[model samples]
Target: MAHKKSFEALDRTQQDLRGNSELMGGALVILFGDFRQTLPVIPKSTPADEINGFLKQSFLE
Candidate 1:
């Protein structure tokens, strides 16, 4: 799983590139993963920070 910011950045980039304000610029996005398997790793970060960095904890979720 990736960090929320990573997904957000992708969304922003897609929006900018496609000139669409919608999520992922209304592109066809296919994601395959086991979200429960692992969380995003934040180097030198606290447990709380790591948890909060999860994609599930983001607006995209």
Candidate 2:
């Protein structure tokens, strides 16, 4: 979340830095990422491999 003015990126592997002190501190924060880059442990999850994953097993189907 480098684009965000008040974002704090977790080290993931190591914990050296924390908090949003570079700019003004705020309460609102937004994060977006690709869900496709996840574990392939799901043996029978049809929606996971399909292009319409979110809608494949949804109630709207």
Candidate 3:
């Protein structure tokens, strides 16, 4: 039997993903937030301009 520390490894992986995703916004921008809750510490961008591009070439008809 092997003792694998999964949770500790996951924290580092999640941190890296968050850092990398900060710069990407060209694709489908899905922002999951609650208006009743406080705002985020990091800045966020809405892909309103990219919406037209995505909709024009989306999978849905």
Candidate 4:
């Protein structure tokens, strides 16, 4: 699982995401999912808590 801190690091730096340079150093990252379709299983947590874990706050999103 990806964390917010890691994405912050990438966002802080300048990256060239063109041609082979895209994946030359770091892996090309992508996120695909619909919050309306599914939600993560946070056992014993309320819906609000689960929603709080949303990745939208991360730069990777």
Top candidate by TM-score: 1
lDDT of 1 by residue, 37-59 (tens): 78888889998998999888888
Candidate closest to the true structure, highest lDDT: 1
> Which pairs clash in model 4?
none
| Shift in Å, residue 16, candidate 1 | 0.8
Q: After superposition, how far is residue 57 of candidate 2 from its true place, in Å?
A: 26
* lDDT tens digits, residue span 18-61, model 4: 32333223555665667455655567988786665545654455
Q: Residue 17 error for model 1, in Å?
A: 0.5
Candidate 4 or 3, higher lDDT: 4
The lDDT values for all models are 0.89, 0.32, 0.33, 0.52
Q: Is candidate 2 or candidate 3 better by lDDT?
A: 3
User: Which lDDT tens digits does candidate 3 get at residues 14-59?
Assistant: 5576664332322333443342233222224354533323322333
Ranking by TM-score: 1, 4, 3, 2
Off by over 4 Å in 4: 1-25
RMSD of each: 1.0, 11.8, 16.2, 6.3
- Each candidate structure's TM-score, on Cα atoms with residue i matched to residue i, is 0.89, 0.17, 0.25, 0.42
- Those runs of model 3 whose alpha carbons end farther than 4 Å from true positions after fitting are 1-4, 20-61
